[model samples]
Target: MNYSVKNILLATSFQHKISVSIFYPENSSNKSIIISSATGVLQKYYSRFASHFSSLGFTVYTFDYYGIGASNSKSIKHITANLNAWAFDQAAVIKYAKETNPEHKIILITHSIGGQLMGLNAEIKLVDSIITIASQTGYWKYFKGFSRFRMFMFWYVLIPFTTPIFGYFPAKKLGLFENIPKQVAYQWRQWGIHPNYMFGHFKNTELYFSTVSCPVLILSFPRDLFASKASVDWLASKLTHAKVDRRHLIPADLNIKDVQHFGYFKKEYQDSLWKLTETWINENS
Candidate 1:
């Protein structure tokens, strides 16, 4: 179970440098995993999860999207990053993992927007399988009650008013999320208002979803206010060709009080919910 951790810098097609971390076990294995983080969530936050996967005999890779975390430029305001750029960055990371471990199966584990953006990756067909955790489309109508109100304020009011002043979304100051790039904020705002979410904005969205033929496992929590069951179902409905396994986790079934959108990734769930995740990956991947 011994593993080594290393940090490296990768260059995008446009020559922008991105920060990536690799976790490899001492013994080689034929399975490798790429952990794609949620929006405004840093790679560092997922380091524990990466290490856990590496200990399980699978080489694990985690990276920060451009204009976020360690990958951001010296002046974030000057950086122009959109959803396409984020997908390209993820694709570049996948390409690196495949080339580095040619014999290993490349499995993708994505969270939130990471799953939504998979269609944007030109190299997605190269992946063996995908596992989406709390992933869903962000259409405002899919949400109800307090969650809907919160989404409205976040997308319509906060993002619009702050980006003009800070030249970027001041997520950290507002305690919403990590600071986000202006373009990312704008694109998210657009997607949130549309009934189809990102599908409405991305050209050839259907084609992108159709290209993915590998099996997909989607795990969602009943208590997740952000990614409701309806939202997650909408995402699953789009991947018509893929053999999709969608499961809803009830905290009571797991002997836990509650599990939210970000709770599953926390260290406290390492033994309970995390073990369930490992079991699914072992069976599917």
Candidate 2:
């Protein structure tokens, strides 16, 4: 079950060089996976998950969006990476994987904002299937009770006020996430206030979703504050042409107390939730 990891720099069409890492088994196979990270999160955060899939005999790839992680060459304050630009970086990685493993069936595993921006990729049809983990629209109203209030403060009060002053989102200082580019932060803020979230801001949103016909597997955790059930449902409803399978995970089912938004990627859930993910991928692939 040994695997090898290598760091790569992918060149995007927009003249940006993105940092990417590939994890592959000692003996390769015809099935490969691309792990697209959530907004403001680095590629290294998903190293363990990529290694797990690599051990399962699938070639796995993880990359950082432009102006984040290894891809951030200059100061984020000077970068203008928006959602579309991030998608271009993602599409470049997907294209590289497709060309490198021409015989392999590529499966895209997206987390959070990764899923929301999938429609922006022009090379999306190269993907054979998609597995969205805790992916949802970012409309703040989707949250109820205290969660709604917290989101309101976060989107309305915190982001608008701080991002303008800081030139970028200093989420790292708050232990929320890696520092985000200004455009990315502003675009997210715009979505947070919109009724349809990302769909409301993305151009030709309906056409984009309609063109994605590959089978999709949506995974969500009940205790995940950000991607609530309603938000996940809203995303699923957009992909009308895709054969979608939705699964909700409860910590109790795994004999645990809590599995929050980022819990599924943690090593502790490898035996339970991770195994379930592998099983679903195997069955669907």
RMSD each, Å: 1.4, 1.4
lDDT string for model 2 (1-285, tens) is 499999988999988899999997987768999999998899999999999889888999999999998999998889987888898988898999999999999999999989887878888889988999988988888888877887888889888999999999999887799999988888889989999787676667533667788889998888688888888888888888998998787788779658778887889888988898788777877
Q: Candidate 1, residues 53-95: lDDT per residue as tens digits?
A: 7887889999999999899867779889887889888899999
Clashing pairs in 1: none
TM-score each candidate. Answer: 0.96, 0.96
**Total clashes in model 2, counting residue pairs 3 or more apart in sequence or in different chains:** 0
Candidate 2 TM-score versus the reference: 0.96
* Candidate 2: worst-modelled 10 consecutive residues by lDDT: 199-208
Provide the lDDT at 264 for model 2: 76
Model 1 alpha-carbon miss at residue 110, Å: 0.8
